[model samples]
Target: MLISLMGYSMSINLILILKAILILVLGYFAVKIVSSILENGAKKSKIPELVSEFVIKLFSAILYVFVILLAVGVFGVETGPIILGLSASLGLILGFGLQDTLTNLTSGLWIAVMKPLDKDETVQIGGITGKIVEVGIMATKLLTPDNVVITIPNKLVWGSPITNYTRMDLRRVDVAVGVSYGENLDNALSKALELISEHPKVLKDPAPAVVVTGLGESSVDLQLRAWTKTGDYWGVKGDLTKGIYEKYGKEGIEIPFPQMDIHVHKY
Candidate 1:
């Protein structure tokens, strides 16, 4: 009878050990699979990379906790109360200590909901202009045209003025050009309009406009206004400036520069 009792006890101990091992091994792989599913779903749903990564990591962490609890149960240890106590303690501590962090997190959530600017879009916010690399949990990352990376806290971004250039299909380009006072205003206007119209990127629907906006101290200031695709705005504006410079040289239209007039006084 004693031998049979000892045999039963050994079998129970072995089963408990096996259960712990199985939970640990299976839980590890399970977390990986779930993380992969979440990644694919995020991609399919058009979620940003940073958001998807956060979700997957958070889910995996929660899953690991449960797996650990189950494994501890196999050893006859009660983990529920301990987990609750730790969670409460951590939450209280974090709530009291992480004011700015919490603000950033809340602001980030607000940004996600409002979506004033999206990933890969060009935007100017909080005195920074760049393409959005990621909208992270704590901050938004921007890649500048000069290849600089800027990480801005979500609170600042949410509170600041945001200018999203990519939000519209087209934008207007304005180039203020100046010609010598001796130049014919009508001829300069026609030539400026002609160059703007001939540019491949400039939109014809709005029609290019060349008007004398102001008379500067040195010359007659002509404003050349044109419409182009937002992506081509900078390129088209540069082209217009260069074309104006070349055309004026070819047609005897003098581009006036700042010069001081001096007169000699005889005493």
Candidate 2:
């Protein structure tokens, strides 16, 4: 009779093991199928790739946790106490040790949702300027102009001010030009405007303007302001400065240098 009871117990244990294996296999396939469907839907919609990927990972993690719990239950294990114990342990550890990580995670979520800077946007955050490549759960990836990849933590990104250079379609290029005090201010202004108008990237609608911003000790400072598309900002700015110099030289407009007149009185 004792031998028969041991045989029965062994048979039940074997059945439970098989059931757990089957459940895990089925759970994996179910998770895959659901993930595929969601990904397909996301692709078809206007959702961003970053957001879609995050959603899939989050759902898959939850499903995996469920599968683990199911497998534990098959062996007649008390999952409630196990879960509670794990939760308490993790909570204590995470609360004390992972505060910064949790802050970064929360900030990343906010950034993903708010989208202050989108993918490929040129931004200067925390004194680092680069084009945004990926916004992840912990950090954001940037490709700098020098071809270096930079990773910035989400906590710092959220805490600092972000300057999105490409946020607006139009950007203003400010150029400063100085001329001799006796030089023709009106002629200099007209020549500057004419040169700015020649640039293809400079917008014609707003109309470029030249203003005498300051009267310096050596020369009069004139600020040339022009509007151009954000993409053409740097090129237009560089070209505009060069063009101004060339045109001024041709028109005999003197770009004055800083000079001070010193008088010495013999004691």
Candidate 3:
């Protein structure tokens, strides 16, 4: 009788193990199918790629946790207690060890929803200027113009002021130039305006202008302001600066050097 009882118990245990394996296999396929569906739906719904990726990953993690618990239940484990214990442990960990990580994650979610910045957009945030590579759950990646990669925590990014340079359709270029105190003020201004106006990239709608900004100790300071398409901002600014110096040289405008005189008397 004892031998028969042991045999029956062994058979039941074997059946339970097989059931657990089957659940795991089905769970794997389910996760795959659900992930694919979510990805396609996000794309079809015109969701931002950043937010889409974050949502998919978050859902996948939760799905995996549930799948594991379901598999464990086949062996007569009580899932309710397990889930409660896991929740308690997660709360404890998040409250202490992962506090900063939790902050970044929440900040990342806010950024994803608000979209203060986007992938490939040039932005200045937290005193760093770069093109956004990716906005992850905990941090943001940036690729600087010099080919350096930077990672910033999302908390700082969300808290700081963001300057997106590429979002605007047009930009204004301001170039400062100085002239000798003795040069023809009106002539210098006219020449500077004409030079900028003739540039192919400068916009005609809001005509370019040169205005006297200040008088330095040795020279008069002027600023050349022009509007151009955003993409041509840097190029236009550089061209205008070089052109001004060359034009002034040919026009005999002397850009004076700073000088100071001292008088001495015998005591």
TM-score for candidate 3: 0.85
Question: Local distance difference test, per candidate?
Answer: 0.86, 0.87, 0.90
What lDDT does candidate 3 reach at residue 177?
Answer: 91
**Candidate 3 on 122-188: residue-level lDDT in tens?**
9999889999999998999999999999999999999999999999899999999999888899999
lDDT tens per residue, model 1, 145-235: 9999999999999989999999899999999889999888899999989988999999988888998888899899999999999989899
Instruction: Give per-residue lDDT, candidate 2, residue 138.
Output: 84
- Sort all candidates by lDDT, best to worst: 3, 2, 1
Error of 1 at 224 (Å): 1.6
Worst 10 residues of 2 by lDDT: 1-10
- Tally clashes: model 3: 0
| Candidate number with greatest TM-score | 3
TM-score of each model, in listed order? 0.77, 0.80, 0.85
Which prediction has the highest lDDT against the true structure?
Answer: 3
Q: For every model in order, what is the number of clashing pairs?
A: 0, 0, 0
> Cα miss at 200, model 3 (Å)?
0.6
